[model samples]
Target: MRKVLNVIALLLLIMVPLLTACGGTSTDSGTSSPGNDSGTDSSGSDSGTKKHKIGILAPAVTHGWVAAVAYNAEARAKELSNDIDYQIQTSSNAEEMTSQLDDLMTWGAEAIVAFPQWEGMEVPIQKALDAGIKVVNFDIVIDAKGVYRVSGDNEDMGIQGAKYIVDKIGKEGNVVMLEVPTSGSVSELRKKGFVDTMKEIAPDMKIETYATKFTREDGLKDFADILTSTPKIDAVYSMDDETSIGVLQAIDEAGRTDIKVVTGGGGMQEYFKMMPENENIWIESALYSPAMVKDAVDVALKLLNGESVEEVKVIPTTIVDRDNYKDFLDDNSPY
Candidate 1:
């Protein structure tokens, strides 16, 4: 009986060792496996990777330049898809833009890039800053605190325009300064730069200041009247490319050969073509490309990445004329 019991006990020990090795009905249901040692959650996704959220706010496309600002900003956002998720909102007025700002804030956007053209944006933009959202201003300047700005040198555009006009038409020529009051500080800064520079360089240069919108229609109608009134105008310090295009047309219709130069701003493809085609007049535009909005987008990303950036970034103005218009031409450009 004792020998039989010993054999049974030996068999039981061997069977138990084999069952334990095969993991018999012993499942680790609540514990993690070796494959999931990297701390993956129940959904099998790692929690360490997180993308930044960026918001872009621009005005409704009223002009080619405005359209390009939106286009370039979206293009850049797509290019950084791996690193960020973005939302772009286009508003027609300050009130609409304020609403859009609220929407972006609700969306939990880490940073916002704003291209505000209208007034009354200060209060709402300040509200955004108070919410701990980083705001990046593009093109148009606003009165909001803690906002970073990225724009072309507006005042330097005026300085370059004055220099170009004086160089082409001489120091003592008559210049028609077309100012767009609707453009606010853009017109103000450009005008200030031109006037200040002209005063320092060509004090005797007769400047006829007039207000006009930044449109071909306004340029044609307003310049036609100015051409009729001022018979001996040597140049026109037009503040926009669209305005300059119309001014050229008005000059052609009126058959004015007295005007020697037409200065413009905002780099337009059509205007660049006009520079080479018009041989008689020195057609010049201080190159303020709307693509600068891309820089504003970049600044927003930099801020979100905890990178140090300037409070204000101003892209230097490039003077384009018949001599170098081809170099500035972009067939894909909307403006």
Candidate 2:
């Protein structure tokens, strides 16, 4: 009887070890256990917490404003790193941008913030919309349907430029208007605002429109030629800060004393520095900041999270001149 009892006890010990091993395996299947080396429950912490994937499409750094657009976009992305995963692509032209768009789509991007400055992007952008990927446009306007846009008040910049010029140089003066034709809607809206406002307030104001690109090199070269042909100019309406910088240099080099006021757009630091230095010329800039791209990124995220957003969000323009230029100055600003 004693031998049989000892045998039963030995059997119970062996079965206890096997049962304990089976229990551990069952625990791993249900929750965290020694076999579950991942240190998470069977119901993962990341089950419903997948990060949103966002893609940014911008123009390559052709200008300081363009560079700042990319810079601000990256800054905003970093700020929201935990909430999102992002990819930014810059291109010189439409074809390159289209290829980048395809890459982003292939990567399973949930939303794309596009700055399609070049033409022929409408078809590709529309395709992205059809695929159910949200697109948010920055600055330059395109004809893509259902795409959100975030931009400074471009037309108001022209209106403010007109108002500033009229106030400083008076209603009667020869104004050389530098218009950037390649900018498409941006130029048209700004020109329309300036022209319409000028006609309404100062119909007698003699305005001459000329084509120029948005570069200091173009501004200097074009304005130098404009100075030679057109005499007795009172004010110059320049649609960009870089262009105005060139225009200012041409005026200084030519020793022209007739020009009293110069209006500019886009918040540029170097251009703002010139405002206080040149006491004679009322160097004014209507603030169309590259920082506005941050808002575009925000719009993209908002749409991804199923939040309501406006089709177009136009940020109001802030007119900065010699008096207020110092207030708007940022040493960290790339543009």
Candidate 3:
């Protein structure tokens, strides 16, 4: 009985230390404590060697504007810091975007910047937020809470475009609008601003709006169809540079000399070049600069550094025309 008692006492002495080291406790079920770390320093703090990871989700480079955005974003990310790493994902459609976002999250991105090509991504955005990741939405507005959105004033672009038309046409002619995609927030705001301003300023002018996808091919096809159906189109206003290119193509093919002007948003290099020289088709373009990417990344860096930023950052827009185009034009500008 004495030997048995001695063996029991030795076992208790060994097991008690093991259990305590393993964080055994009556209140907790698991063997390890939730916040305890065995490798922490004397101050109970982690070393500051871990670098931050940033993820960028941009739409496919389908047009010059999108291409510029991607270029500037990649360039700025590399130029930002050595301790910060970035991964970029491009998606052709909404379904691909869903999967791309999932992969980004799984890669342990500390923060994400997105230019959503389509709507209905609120679920994925919310999921990232739930996981304690910061989200910065660029260009496109997702209408979700706790997201930092950065873009130019979309409605102001429309108001400027419409005011230009009214000034040029002098308030009384048939005008046609080649609109951007109705599903996009930028397009919708621009379209609304244009229509409202036209009604307020040029009430006598007859305005017709065509809702079409913002693509060169779609713009050409839709503009051609409209020209065939309508007898006279005094002026045409487009929401994108690619769509403007299409409208120009259709107008040249039809040999319609009656149309006075064509205007587009986005400072595409091609549009800037043509606006100064082109006599027949394009006359003006509103400057919705693609340099907003740089600003967004700058804001993200500030946030990561524990700095404060405005919840909504709005960049300025300018009207580019023959008179003032030279001021805003940069021959070496990528866009």
Candidate 4:
């Protein structure tokens, strides 16, 4: 009887651990299911379906080009279907930008597509990376490794702009440069290419640089000051179309016929319209179209679908003048 009681006790002890082990395994299996992971159901449609959440941070639409970028991003996000969800946030400055990014991370963003409006956003971006979020820097680039970047060939655009200006002004003349902020990578590369090419091709030409913001009003004010400071401005190379508009206004108001050419980047409608008719002044522009949002979205989708993309994807840019204006001009184009 004693042996039988000991055997019964041993059986009970063995069954207790087995039951406990089964219970723990059940709990873990429940937690580890596919649907319970955060941001894995970004579509927010049917329950139990896997999904992805993508966040986008862009600059506020202070200008036409930025506005176009914002519009395209929103439209493309919606068109991507129910498997992916996107949250877009716009910021006008650095403080607001950081706060917005924090909110997105809290909401369980699996990936981020950011166009850092200014410099010094590296810290917040690095934080996102530490949290295991995949980041894609669109249009603008920040100095962060392992982050994908999609942008136009800014240096090439500048080289094209310089070539156009040199061709119009001949070997030797006084050329005025309307410059944007140095903090932006696009602006820096474009300016460098332009300056270097000018030195290479038109060694005799004197180049004057004037600092201006990426706005029509700033362009006008800065160019007005340039007109007052410099007497013999033979040609003007505006960095952007908005700046070119202001430069054109300044030149028209000052009646500066000595300015033979006004060249710009970006395919603005106003510039396209002016290129065909403005024969005397030789109006030409490098085409830095604001269609990169579509490309970014496409790449993001490919990534989500388990495909690989290049770390840095550069969209091709072209020069648009009167001779080839028709090829680039789209009547229904947003930019």
- TM-scores for all candidates? 0.85, 0.87, 0.82, 0.83
lDDT score for candidate 2 against the true structure: 0.89
- Badly placed stretches (over 4 Å) of model 2 are 1-48
**Angstrom error at residue 106, model 4:** 1.0
What is candidate 4's lDDT per residue for 107-201, written digit by digit as tens?
78787888886988889988898888888888777877667878888899888888888777788999888778744887888899999998899
- Tens-digit lDDT string for candidate 1 (269-326): 9999998787899999999988899899899999998999999999999999999999
Model 3 lDDT per residue over 116-208, tens place: 868778888888888888888888888677889889888998898888888877788999987767548988899888889988998888988
When sorted by lDDT, best at the front, the candidate numbers are 2, 1, 3, 4
> What lDDT would each prediction earn against the true structure?
0.89, 0.89, 0.80, 0.79
Candidate 2 has which clashing residue pairs, if any? none
Lowest lDDT sum, 10 consecutive residues, model 1, at 31-40
Candidate 2 local lDDT, residue 153: 91
Model 4 scores a TM of 0.83
Candidate 1: stretches off by over 4 Å: 1-48
lDDT of 2 by residue, 219-262 (tens): 99999999999978999999999999999999999999999999
Each prediction's Cα RMSD? 8.0, 6.1, 10.5, 10.0
